[model samples]
Target chain A: MKKLIMIFSLGILFLLSACAGENSASGNSSQSTGNKNSEAGTKDGKQVVTFWHSMGGAGQETLNSIVEDFNNSQDKVQVNAEYQGTYDESLTKFNAVAGTDSAPTMIQTFEIGTMSMINSGNIIPIQEFVDKDGYDMSGLEGNITNYYSLDGKFYSMPFNSSTPVMYYNKDAFKKAGLDPEKAPETFEEVEEASKAIVKSNPNMKGFALQAYGWLWEQLLANQGALLLNNDNGRTDTPTKIGWTEKEGKSIFEWVKRMVDDGTFANYGTNGDNMVAGFLAGDVAMFLQSSASARDVIDNAPFEVGIAFLPYPEDQERQGVVIGGASLWMIDGKPKEESKAAWEFMKYLQTPEVQAKWHVGTGYFAVNPAAYEEDVVKEAWAEKPQLQVTVQQLQSTKSSYATQGALMDMLPQGRKIMETALETVYNGGEVDQAYKTAVQQFNDAIEQANKARKK
Target chain B: MSMNPTLETNETYMYQFERVKKSARMKSFIKGMLFLFPSILLFSVFVFYPMFKTIYLSFYLTDAKGSTTVFVGLENYLNMFTNPIFLQSIKNTFLFVFYTVPPTVLISLFLAILANENLRGIGLFRTIYSSTIGISVAAASVFWLYLFNPTMGLLNKFLEAFGGEPVGWLTDPAWALLSVSVTTIWMNIGFTFLILLGGLQSIDRSLYESAEVEGSGYFYKLRRITIPMLSPTLFFVITVSMINSFQTFGQIDILTQGGPANETSLIVYSIYREAFVNYQFGSASAQAVVLFILILVMTVIQFKLGERRVHYQ
Candidate 1:
């Protein structure tokens, strides 16, 4: 019995020591990455800049190649780009390690995360770097730059920007006796098109809208409607949702009309499934990010038509908000490491790199000069649909609605709207769903403010 | 008074004897504690500390970093009860448990009984029956996700082939929770089956021999002997399966993501969304505390009521 006790104690000691070792090893690595009060540590005489991004698939491949090019361009900095799941997941992780040594030198956060990243108190605004470096901000695209800057101060460097565009099967339009070149431009038009498509082919649905909060916001913006109050939370903090009852309810009612007609396909909160549905000829048209242009065009058996986001007939098209991520420099990093990351960020803004990014993924070139590049010219010549996404952004009327809302609660608010949209798709009364969503959204914003007061 | 000297000496002797016995008992207690020290230390760091922290955080409003900002007292708890989403989540969780547990237990028991029979190639059949236990939750969920896809899923294809309208397996509000529950039940059956089969094999062969010699029919013997003998395992499997159903997360995440208007958002998934996604750690902690109490009460009730029927040979 005594011998058995000794062995058991020894075994436990071994496990405890192993756990301690693992903890210390992780602690050491984080410290080495974010060295404070000391010169930023170098790997092989090159400053290491850890960049956490949330780009997957083709975007990831393009980003990795760009990083490789940046690394090979000079020997002074070795930028390590890490793919950190989705925007939601990576943001959660960043929140957990925001001020800690484990935090990256820089992080790419989604457009909606801009307000939270600024409020996080763990980042250095891009305005400082721009001023210090004398970088020409005017060279970037106006619509893209407008989304990133607040009060003429850039908080983050816009990267991989996109906008919502309507993708439709051109072949289905021809078969339905509708003009193949002209896509639906208004909510009523889309409904009519859906009816025509369904009338042409009973197996195919006329339209599909994935129950997504981003799409809902884009649809509202396309109608020149704001998402949150207080000038879309730009001039002041938002207290409630910005859109009027009519503006908000129009989207629901339009979807309800489609549902009532049995021409709407609902893919609840699953974008991939919606895309698959489109590819399988189950749905003729859908609204999705322009970033999916290359994938959709390449995979579709039919000619895919990319068009501007549809709006209500009464409201003029207000265009779309930049719908991708931006890079923010983390605080508490050494000046040299930040400068190195800044250099890489500038490299990403160059016309050559942006052109590659634009052609490689359906995302817009933050630098408009990239549109002048031969690569972009050749790609557009081959597939004219890609240019429609860029044209929409260029034509956007800059307003508080198109600039998009700023609030940490936007993500939560999105979830509320998504649930509301799902209710409408599932045949719930539009007024009831809209009212419940607005109430819950206001409560979330109020709760957020109350939480922040202390 | 002088004649009581012997009695007084006897009292002092008894006091010394009691003191020695007390010290000896204390030594044994210390030794036992020493033997239990490892597990106690591990549990204190991992389980007990976190549990107490969760309870402590439940009363305070926390910032994005999860640090306490304001003392809200019972506000978080009160808000949860009034929150329709939370209430729906609780109802859905109970519904999911009902949908999954009995089916899992019954089907696994039926499979276990069939696989327990002495027959040729029984090992191969047992392997096939228990194969899913080797598959991880993530892999199994992804497999089911493809099968449940609304557009190009095998299920929809089969329905279309039969000239039936395609059902939105994971898209419709009424069907999403049931679809997730079906995936969970399929994933759970293998582990439950293996455990039940092990229990079936451990039963004394002579008991079955006597039942057969008495000319008791198959169904009769199974009712009188097999079920009574397997009662202990059945009780254990039911309790565990119930708890597992209550805590189901992975399949729901992969399959439904608590979508179609939050129909499949179970308690744990709701708590996750509240804390990690919404960053409402205070309310999440309150929900966690409620879930803890719920699971504790359920387990206590099971122990009290179930143990009476468990025949431990």
Candidate 2:
């Protein structure tokens, strides 16, 4: 009888858990409906805009406060900002609920996700709102507008923007007898500096490049090389990679030379660790997103100097593509809710809010006029490193390569490049790694194109 | 006429007996089904449906939303076999299982034996031995991630203090899998230890007492009596550990993310990357099917070969 009772209880427990699992899955799918009902039933007359973002840490804090300010500034719309993990995770969640009523009022997606977002048919083009409101998008930063716009049409509102910059230890440069004021502007110069730094202090490695695909893209752009065929996939669907062997192999061979000299620090795909290593003085220089400028500048014990992204000596500097996310208005939302979201997005673009955003986070102000704001001027005065990021963006040549590639398969391409970069970092043959990466990248592009047909 | 009537009555009596037996059998079968209904419902909803869906999806191409896009029979499976990264992941997963399973079982068994002693503070030692069961995979992996950090991590600092060069635990392709395996073994020990300790304690004391009376030594009794008695628990632990290691995802995600030239990208992580990250559900489903078959075959072989050795006392 006891054994029978035990089995019976275990069965009950299993049944309950199974039911719970089903309930939760349904709950996720029905979240928007639940939210809508609650908002409608609320006593307040204000419309609710469910805003989803992928900001974390300092960025999240600043974004939340900005939302609160926007809510308090007016009673017509109450924007609820929800953090939805990293860009990859958030995009995955958005994909799951894309066409369903469970989707949020609006979402912030990374730049590489632009093509996929447009193709998903789950987002309303921001151009409709721009035309209706007669919003002057030209007032936004030119480089940012270039990246967010395609054929003079805005599909998404440009929010936070950043570029790749070389962060170096000025103290280490001085100690190595290199001029602290003048930074390395070419790959060959960086290599020479790295060797000097390592020779001066064997304890500190010369350079660290976190095996990140976005950085690879930036490096390619700086060398005037396109990442995809047909004008970086802007003219037509890309069939294969665009960069020449010399353009692609220059970056790899540079890193390989440094590695052979034992001056390269391999942090292998973990940006946090590379930054940590930099702060801990294990490395003298590294390349990373300018969005991390504030964190790196504040944490480093030594004098930090920010410089332009280095290009190959054989190629001219073409500058960097915008490396950040944009605000997308989700489709299928109520007209009132979308209008409220649009209002919040407009509020975010004003010089005051953009200034606050730029000062609070290392991300560039989408509105160029934000630089005139006192807060931004004061912040830039204190940390001139922030000014370099804006300068880099402003100086970026208006080319299709610098405008970045448009493809649904960029995220997959990134992983392929990251793996190839890691292979090179771990002492694999560069030619072999590059060949495999290119093959996989082209295959991914083809597969993505095929998958979209049905 | 009287003889005919008696024969008819006898036939009716036998027919009634047969009908009664059939009705009783039907009633018992209904009762058994009623008892099994809950489990059947759960399994159908969770397991059978997904298994069938995965198999069906393995024959098609899917879009980002996971809806079937094209009917390409066996294309997804063939592509997986041809893909070098997928082949590498398979090799890494099997290597991970080999690296993690035996050591986890053996180390836990050793700890269980030691903690099973009747010392004054044996409870404390047992608690310490089994404490890792409380630490979640994410939290434990994060902890080990810091310990394995090349620059400021405690492990590297210790190595440097010993006058040895720092090693990239997760960065070097040669060491990344070994590093991940070490973390898995550490995380798996607590549960295995507790289970083995329970098995050790529940063994008949009389068997040990009789062995002691026969003037047998510790190793002799452990080999002849204890091992045979504990074989069932050992077998259970081994099987669970093997399955758990094969399905390892959290630690790999947190620690390595299948990095260092895809050396640490095991089967499950690869599936997640394919389905979620790359948004290719068809190929991911095919990989899942392969993994399912692999685990099923291995488990079947283990049960077939291992059950003969287990003494289920």
- Per-prediction DockQ comes to 0.40, 0.46
Write model 1 residue lDDT over A1-454, tens digit each, in one string.
Answer: 3234335433433343233223224335444544431234588889889898999988999999999999999999998888777898778878877887678889999999998888889999999999999999999999887788999999999988999999999999999999989998999999999999999999999999999999999999998899999999999989988999999999999999999999999999999999999999999999999999999999999999999999999989899988999999999987998999999999999999999999999999999999999999999999999999999999999998999899988889889989999999999999999999999999999888878882
Shift in Å, residue B86, candidate 1: 0.6
DockQ of 2: 0.46
Q: After superposition, how far is residue A405 of candidate 1 from its true place, in Å?
A: 0.6
- Angstrom error of the Cα, residue A78, model 2: value is 1.4
Predicted candidate 2 versus true structure: per-residue lDDT over B99-122, tens digit per residue: 999999999999998998899988
Worst 10 residues of 2 chain B by lDDT: B295-304
RMSD to the true structure for each prediction, in A, is 4.4, 3.4
Off by over 4 Å in 2: A1-43, B1-19
Worst 10 residues of 2 chain A by lDDT: A15-24
**Pairs of residues at least 3 apart in sequence or in different chains that clash in candidate 2:** none
Model 2: per-residue Cα lDDT over A1-454, one tens digit each: 3234335433433343233223125336446653664356323888888888889988999999999999899889888787777898888878887776668889999999999999889999999999999999989988888899989999999998889999999999999999998999999999999999999999999999999999999999988889999999899988888899899888899999999899999999999999999998899999998988988999898899999999988789999999999999999888988988999999999999999998888899999899999999999889999999999988889898898999988999999999999999989999999999989998998888888872
* lDDT of candidates 1 onward, in order: 0.88, 0.88
Q: Which lDDT value does model 1 have at B213?
A: 91
